[model samples]
Target chain A: MIPTLQVFLIVSAALFSAGLLAALSRRHAIFILIGIEMMLAAANLNFIAFWRFNPQSQPPTGVMIAIFSIAIAAAEAAVGLALVIAEF
Target chain B: MSSAAFVLIAILTLAAALAAATLQKLMHATLSFAVALVGVAAFFFLLGAEFVGLVLVFVYIGAVAVLIVFTILLTRRDVGKDRGANWSGALLAVAVFGGLGWAVFKTQSVAIAAPHIRALTVKRIGEALMTSYVWPLQCVGLLLTAALIGALVLVMEEKR
Candidate 1:
């Protein structure tokens, strides 16, 4: 019953595509930022999926990377929004 | 059962993402983006990454999304008008998706065996972060602190 790696990959791909569409299509600065965040989320999902499905008994590198990605994303949002606000 | 759960979550995620991308209103798009973020967090949970899932919720949904909303509110008058989607951008997105999909399908034939599910406790993650990942952890902390300070400086009002 568990979803396979392919399923996760496809979902992430779709997410990435949607994000790309948003990023490229949106005219508002904030919407563009949201799209960028979605893209980051898509990449994070891929990392987690690959980590989950990897056959090797490895360290929790993928999870750690995801954690760092979230942190960086938070930072990016803060700075990006501040810049957006300052521009106004 | 689990596949069904995944399909449902995937549908929710993609739908929210589509709405976020296509919505004309900034507020509505932000809300949809929040839903998409929550969906991604749910995905992390389903993948057995409990710690990451919680962080995704805490950091993304709680902090980032709120920050975005706050920014929008602050600059509401400036960004009141919503513009239509750019056709060129849509075309680019479609091209990128097609290329990526083709790549994925081409490599789909490689049989990657399912990994055994191990219980990943928060304690183990903490241990790893403090031990092997200490350098990166410290670096990220520094980066976040710098970003906070920089944002504050950027938004500070100047007197005439």
Candidate 2:
């Protein structure tokens, strides 16, 4: 059986919490960046879940948003790591 | 069956995320993060977002994870030994989680209609991206180019 929307939302929340723990608790800059990535992933999951469960015959907006999010995330990582290296 | 698959994926994702957060070695943490990313890709697949799922794997696991590992290697000397979790950080995380949990519970009372499932083909997505989303797509491309140039400049050495 397919999981309910609540199930997806709860899982997203858990992942977001885990990401928060990682981002806040970690000392290393790279690990902190990883935490940020996790947070983004959680948000993406929420978007996809909503898209999948929405009653309207919506366009593929959620997938498009996910794609844009991934691209932006890649850019963020590239710049973030570069800054970390420069500081080091 | 799908629910079971979701549960498995959720467990795997959460475990990897926790490992990535709490691990002592940076390398191990990076690997764990990669696993977590893969689990997320699987989630996209479960939601029938095939293109997005593949993109997540290709961009996140293939590119970003590798970049992070490379950065760790280059800055090895700066990555001090794992100092364990800080109480202040833990407290902050807990507080954020608590707030989020409360929000989740609060929203549970509202009822939503049953979703209508339909196939979302790649062709439709492509058309939409080329038309309705074209401007935002161009902006994202510009952002990527700027980020690339910025990274190059940041890493460039000053010649004497």
Candidate 3:
């Protein structure tokens, strides 16, 4: 059977915790950045899950946000890594 | 059939996420993080959001992952194994997961199967972006440009 919305949410939660684990436990700055990125990706997944399951009366809001989110994420990664490079 | 796919992809993603979180080596952790991202893209495709899936693969794996790897290489002065993972952090993560899981189970509304939906096409997304979302799209472009310049300015070597 296709997984329900609950299943997707649970998975996203698991991913978020894993991100927290990385961010909290690791000493490296890069690890912290990775953790943050993972957390963002999980949020995107949650948004997509909600978008997919619900009946759409509006435009593709979820996908649009997700795309914009991805762009922002890339920008964040670039800036973050540059900061890391400048720091260490 | 889709459930099986979901299970497989979920396992892969979760396992990769665990690897990314707990791995001792920095490079290995980064690579596993990339793998986890690929699994997320797979999930997007499975959900019939092919355009989002493609964008995820391109932006994350293609761009972000490469940037991370490059950063690692540049900062390799002491790329030794990271300090060991903390048990307290793991415990806290588990606690948070338990809380979220309980909330998920208690909410009876989210347990329903996915409603039948039409495939999301790139054309619809383009039209929406061009029409209703145009302002936000323009803002994103500006945001990206600012981020690009900011990163360059931050990284440029200072003159003696």
Candidate 4:
């Protein structure tokens, strides 16, 4: 229970860094897409973690942003992969 | 240290994300991403956002993950052997990430002003979506619709 936010933040940073590396280093387009997903997940983690930690003062803006971001991410991935498929 | 469950989830999330990014096999990487997303969903639950967590499962695990794997299957030839990574990129990533980690660490002491969140139920979420967040919600729906149409168009090409 305690330090849950800390753990989540650390994990989110790790995910973001790994995703950035993968996106930069991968040759295949699909792997890059995977990297993008990891980054988005990291962002999502940050949103939820912050929302959890500051439950008494902040509105659920982080949660809403996270959900909206997830929606956008799903759509972006669908379109991006479809284009990649067509291009390849 | 807190309960074992929290530590377990943290480990699972990190391990899954690491595997997802580092695995050489494309299929394995995609699967690992799924695992990582699931772990994140669990984290959301622990954060008291049950609706968001389940939505993550549905959208990520069910839709997005499946879409990526299917795309991989469609373009099977492009997934060549892993080319490994460049040392420069790796070093740059480390330096950039180390700086970011330090920044967050330094800011950890600042107190954040947060409001109390009420229970987020389907009805409450729907009400908020339709009332205050209505425009954004509609925009998202429009975007998703367009993307779906575009996907169909992209995949429905004449056979060569």
In order, how many clashes per candidate? 0, 1, 0, 6
Question: Which residue pairs clash within candidate 3?
Answer: none
Q: Which stretches of candidate 2 lie over 4 Å from their true place?
A: B78-80, B109-114, B158-160
The model with the greatest lDDT is 3
For candidate 3, lDDT tens digit of each residue in A1-88? 7699999999999999999999999889899999999999999998898998887625878888889999898889988888888887
Between 1 and 2, whose DockQ is larger? 1
Candidates in order, TM-scores: namely 0.95, 0.94, 0.96, 0.89
**Candidate 1 chain A worst ten-residue window by lDDT:** A51-60
Query: What is candidate 2's lDDT per residue for B80-118, written digit by digit as tens?
Result: 457777888878877877887677667864234336677
Candidate 4 chain A: 10-residue stretch with minimal lDDT: A51-60
The segments of candidate 3 whose C-alpha lies over 4 angstroms from its true place after superposition are B158-160
Arrange candidates by TM-score, descending. 3, 1, 2, 4
Candidate 2 docking quality: incorrect, acceptable, medium or high: medium
Docking class of 4: medium
RMSD of each: 1.6, 1.8, 1.3, 2.6
Model 1, residue B9: C-alpha shift (Å):
0.3
For each candidate, what is chain B's TM-score? 0.93, 0.91, 0.95, 0.86
Q: TM-scores of the first chain across all predictions?
A: 0.94, 0.93, 0.94, 0.89
CAPRI-style grade of the A/B interface in model 1: medium
* Best prediction by DockQ: 3
Write the candidate numbers in order of decreasing DockQ: 3, 1, 2, 4
Query: What residue pairs are clashing in model 2?
Result: A1-B1
Candidate 3 residue-wise lDDT, B45-133, digit = tens: 98778899899999988998888888888888876479878899989999999999999999999998888777688888899999999
